[model samples]
Target: MPIDWSPLKEIIDQQNRFVLTSHVRPDADALGSELGMALLLRSLGKTVQIINPGATPAHLQFLDPDGEIKSVHDAPALKQAILECDVHIVLDTSAWGQLGEVGKLMQKSTTQKVVIDHHVSSDDLNAIQFKDTSSPATGCLVYDFTQAIDHTPSARAASCLYAAIATDTGWFRFPSTTSKTMRTIANLIDAGANPAELYTLLYEQAAVPRLHLSGIVLQRVATACHGQLAYTYVTQSDFARSKAHPADTENLVNQCMTIAGIRAAFILVQQPNRKYKVSLRSRVDFDVTPIAEQLGGGGHRQASGAMLPGPKDAALKKLIQLFEEELKKQPPAEKNH
Candidate 1:
């Protein structure tokens, strides 16, 4: 169903101060949507602030070259801004747990809240929601917002939105990529998005430490559940040895899926608190959201995530068990030889 963005338009007309945010450890979709929205609101003469629960990963810093995206933990004044803002818009993610400290303030604030997301898993945020699960990325929705108001995003905003859609769709190779998505990409390019430059900055700019971390994580990849499931892990010790940040683990799970005959894949990266951040990926027909939601996380059908408390072995055992049960439901033909 097409969202009637008029309500949001009215809200924008009524409100002046806006604070935009997204889930923790935000990906391109999250950061890009916030940046695009900030530009749109600013063009309309509204004051906007882009704040997040976590800092932008080192690799993604080029998207916000001006350092407009602020982390709440790093800046104490963001809390005041959140409280004083007339409207708060959450992009990319709809889960409160994903919001971290920002979620706490959102709960306490009686001000109007808005959600502009594309994810299937969501909580009742008591805000007017503009969500289309069928949409490939929240960047598409942000583009729709611009169309609803008939406003063109600035070139930089176009680049951000282009990056958001491009990354989320796996460079237009994911199942979610459609002709509509391509048209949006075209529109963004027409608005001055340079795909080649963006791609290089996003992928080709990998650091040596990231390559070392990838080597460590990929070396540990192992298959189970009749060779239908591939899994890997990265420990704090792995980070120490590689001299790489946790962000370096991004997209490592997808590499496991490259193994032919593997129906599903996951990578558990141990967080600073010793909890494991489980990133799950699977083929289109095999939904992973249920698996993620079972563990208090939620995402798309093909890609989802969860956090699991771990002694490492225990968590691995649990994940294997879950994947085993899930794979069992598949037809015999779907199983690997």
Candidate 2:
């Protein structure tokens, strides 16, 4: 069912305390939307508390200039905060599973539940779900929601939203991005977001280890399907050697797609317990969503991901086979007969 926000607005108007959360191992879209909405609600005289399953990535610390986001590692404190809230807003992620185990408590609460997300698969979650998969980023939806309620978004809110839109759309380079996305970004800029500063912080501010890790990842890049598809895997040992945090792997898949002949790219990062986190990127007409769904995950066509539970080599082999199968499914290019 399509979402109706009037009831949610009424609940917000009557509520005094609000809790905001997003998915675990959050990206800029998740963290930014969480913080942005929290700030907007706070401006409306609501006591807003932002919570997440883990710590914010170091690169995103700029979003929380006041350092207000609380992690679930401090569950005792976060539980108290959750108890105080009359409403809970889950951002970026739709399913409670994305929140990790801590979110189960939020799911059980009788408090009004509101979800703001842009993922296509999130519509099935329990809440007053406000989802627009057509929107380039959840941040765009968040911006519209704030304006719909006539709330004057704070600079922090605008900046966070800006970051969310920018990161999720690959700096306005993805096909999902539209003129409206550009205009939305312009509005955020007018509302006081500093694009130059944000660009520097998100991309140029990487640490030495992250840069070295990127070099290693590029050196090992492998291509398939006549160079139409490419993949790279980073083992646990690679991280230890470079002293790179898992978060450092963010946006690494995009690098593989930079090759002129590549239409799709994949990156499989080895995680604890022999599990692998797979990220996919596509250019032009290729859709990767079905590939992710086949592996028990979901995301947009051009940008999707999944997790494989097995040894790195085995997982990579399986992924390569799957990739080959998907490529065969695509119609052969038109031949000048």
**Winning model by lDDT:** 1
- Per-residue lDDT of 1-337 in model 2, one digit per residue for the tens? 4346687778888888888888898889998888788788878888888888888877788888777887877669787677567888888878767887548777666777888888756345568878877888889888887877887677778999999999999899877899989988998999989999999988898789998899899899999887888999898888999999888897689889889878789999998667899999887668888899999998877789999987877888888888888877874466587
Candidate 1 lDDT over residue span 1-337, tens digit each: 9999999999999999999999999999999999999999999999999989989987789999999999988777999898889999999988898998988998999989999998876496888999999999999999999998999989989999999999999899987899999999999999999999999998897789999999988989999998889999999999999899887898799899999988899999999999999999998668888899899998777889999999999999999999988877754454476
lDDT of 1 at 147: 93
For residue 303, give model 1's deviation from the true position in Å: 4.4
Q: TM-scores of the models, in the given order?
A: 0.83, 0.84
Report the Cα lDDT for residue 189, model 2: 93
Alpha-carbon error at 222 in model 2, in Å? Answer: 3.8
Clashing pairs for predicted structure model 1, backbone only: none
What lDDT does the true structure give each of the candidates?
0.92, 0.83
Candidate 2 at 241: error in angstroms?
Answer: 5.1
